[model samples]
Target: MARTTSLSGFPEWLPEERIVEQHVLDSLRRTFELHGFSSIETRAVETVEQLLRKGEIDKEVYGVSRLQQDEDSSREDALALHFDLTVPFARYVVENSGYLTFPFRRYQIQKVWRGERPQEGRAREFTQADIDVVGDGTLAFRYDVELALVMIEALSELPIPPFVLRVNNRKLAEGFYRGVGLTDAPAVLREIDKLEKIGAEQVSRNLQDTVGATPEQAEAALSLAAIRTEDTSFVERVRELGVSNNLLDEGLNELAEVVGEASRRAPGKVVADLSIARGLDYYTGTVYETVLVGHEQLGSVCSGGRYESLASSGKKTYPGVGLSIGVTRLVTRILSRSMAQASRSVPSAVLVALNDDASWSAAQDVAGQLRARGIATEVAATAQKFGKQIRYAERRGIPFVWFSSVAEDGSPTHEVKDIRSGEQVAADPASWQPPAEDLHATVLRAATTDD
Candidate 1:
């Protein structure tokens, strides 16, 4: 049965693109584990109250309910699919507080759902990979700096173009607002966050109308947000703005430490960008956003920050800092733009050809030997003609084709042909090995339009 219509906002990948996604996820997983972060997963659903604990994100959440003859919706707590991993992870931390270790370092990669309108890079359902470090009562600031380094390390190893990790301090923005006699800092930050979406003139108007900011104060906030430096020089730039507050001083010092260390370790990989006011209400300290060199229009493909009391029991508060990569969005862009591709569409490197209907056993035997030698081999599905079998392998980009027959001495003999080079050689299955990179499908960069 075929469906009459397809749903919008839900995206699916073809085989090659799925392979590329797996490669990207595997690379991130390895990097996270290398930094001593353990893997974790949370339930897909949380109570409606828990999901709404953050703010007005309810418009994007999908609520869950059962429809039956005797289903009592009032008797049970309302449940909804999680829109992001962080919230559920926080709930898990609180629920399992006694079982988990303090300063928990964890990495979660899973599918999350939302009911938002779809766009070029946004989807209703997508995969997000997050690496977070949470501490009971207090989290160290070093994790805030080191998380960026780890993300940079992981992203550099992938096929994407060079990316700059843009760092900021929420305190700087809020404190600056406070210094300028504005009390509603979050509301002002929200307007500033829309600088690109709603243009400068509109943001300035909203900053004045919504938060009662003076004309000069709004412009000063814009100037501060616009300041971006490749080194700790951003501290001086903030100082030049003439706003002073204890929080402002603390934010400047913390941002400087992060950008300074990032510069020394991986020069040019991180920058202190002043305008990075994360609109999310939770971020309390340093925040980050990343942009690909030539693909800034895609927006920040990875972003996160520090949170206080987001994960806590009444007795103790867990302050954690983390970053999350938009896996589905990245994969979708790579495939849509032809930025990268899998070397081959199929996993099998060699297809054992069937000589005749009676020779099926011989081909299977040859495949078994190849398998024993750690080669990815598959027997022909039918007793197709030799040319047809070769064409089958060619279509799937399988590199090698094997033919088998019995010799005069009644011993089975096997021959292999490299389809890519048209080179034929008699071989012993136990000793033959394909080139390391060719043994399985590999992801590689695709040629650009100019190339």
Candidate 2:
């Protein structure tokens, strides 16, 4: 085995843990495709200018350049590894607008790099599963609801604890802030985003001191953030606050539509949470933040929102709604807490035992037939003793082992043993089948234990 050193912010999983991660990626991909989202992967690096156009994420962007440059070489456009899939997808849309149909829906599952501190659920390099729908010039509000529903369905397929998709609208927030006489709605929103981390009192203070809000305005902002409901009643509660604006009315209607439709479709999975003011400035409409039940400390395991103008050509603009699942973060928490695990560390379901050097060719022939039937089979390496070969299969978590020999009638005989149950039975390589459950490595949810 080769010696290894660990990197602080970059995570590498063991074989079993990787199995769990792959299962998650596969599940999300299937769900995305079922919802009519085609998959696409953008290049890893993008121009720094294109990246910095979004928001103040410059601190997290990892710049890339040649290690050695010729003294006389002209400087090239600065490039950096993408921090998220949304920005790159935006650029891709603009670059390929002519070829793609309107309302292009895409799903991307790829590794993204961010220069952030190493902490639980936060990494410098991680995999994110993203789904977005972009339209030329204009996008429909129905897509906002559709993305939420699709994300809720995808997450429902995972083995994690139950979750709630908390959603909000930026238009509602900005409109409310403006109604309260605050000119810099974005500045207020940035402070409000920290309400959960820094507490309502500190956020209120920041609103007054940093964002230049009056005491009443800060109080109203806190009040709005406190409103959360599982149904459309949140609209009535906001109306009771006595704030009114055309933008606020539009936001209220959009949010009600999302919550109302999503509730009917996926009950107990969606909420109208006014406090979910996503810190990103680009989110123009509905924003989402999901937390696993009983694991709130992990923060939002999935998050995203709507962007009205992230992608645009000279004559056309692509507005979109999207959501991303932090695959690495979810997997890290699942493994650390024993929430789930793989049934086996390796992919092989059956191991063929060689009786002797002469039987090696026969073992290979049997393995070939098994592989042809879609069974994952491997032949022993050195034709070791029967017991020793079985032990090797056991160590690898291979459930079944095959033995072949010549019968008294001079006919080839094959038998397979279920090592876990110690049951051996005659089987033909061309016809025998393992139980469906044992055909592949499966992700199993760990049983709950009393504290």
Which predicted model would earn the best TM-score? 2
What TM-score fits each model? Answer: 0.95, 0.97
Q: What TM-score does prediction 2 earn?
A: 0.97
Off by over 4 Å in 2: 1-5, 70-76, 448-451
lDDT of candidate model 1 versus the reference: 0.86
Worst 10-residue stretch by lDDT in candidate 2?
A: 1-10
Per-model RMSD to reference = 2.5, 2.1
Candidate 1 per-residue lDDT over residues 1-451, each given as its tens digit: 1111267767777677778899999999999999999999999999998888875788999988766524655524888999999889888888887888978999999999999788767889899999999988888899998998999998887777778999999987788888988888889888888887878899999988888989998898888988989998888878888988998888998898899999999998898988888777888999999988888888889999999978877868888998999988888777777778999888899999987888888778778988887889988989888899999999988999988778999987878999989999898887888889988899988655111
Q: For model 1, how many clashes?
A: 0
Model 1 is weakest, by summed lDDT over 10 consecutive residues, at 1-10
lDDT of 2 by residue, 1-451 (tens): 1112277888888889899999999999999999999999999999888898878988999988789855664324778999999999999999998899989999999999999998888989999999999999889899999999999999988878889999999999999999989989989889989988999999999999999988999999999999999999999999999998999999999999999999999999898999998877888889999998788878899999999888987766899999999999999888888888999999999999999988888899999999999999999998888899999999999999999999899999999999999999999999999999999999998775111
**In candidate 1, which residue pairs get closer than 3 Å at backbone N, Cα or C atoms, i.e. clash?**
none
State in Å the error of residue 80, model 2.
0.4
TM-score of decoy 1: 0.95
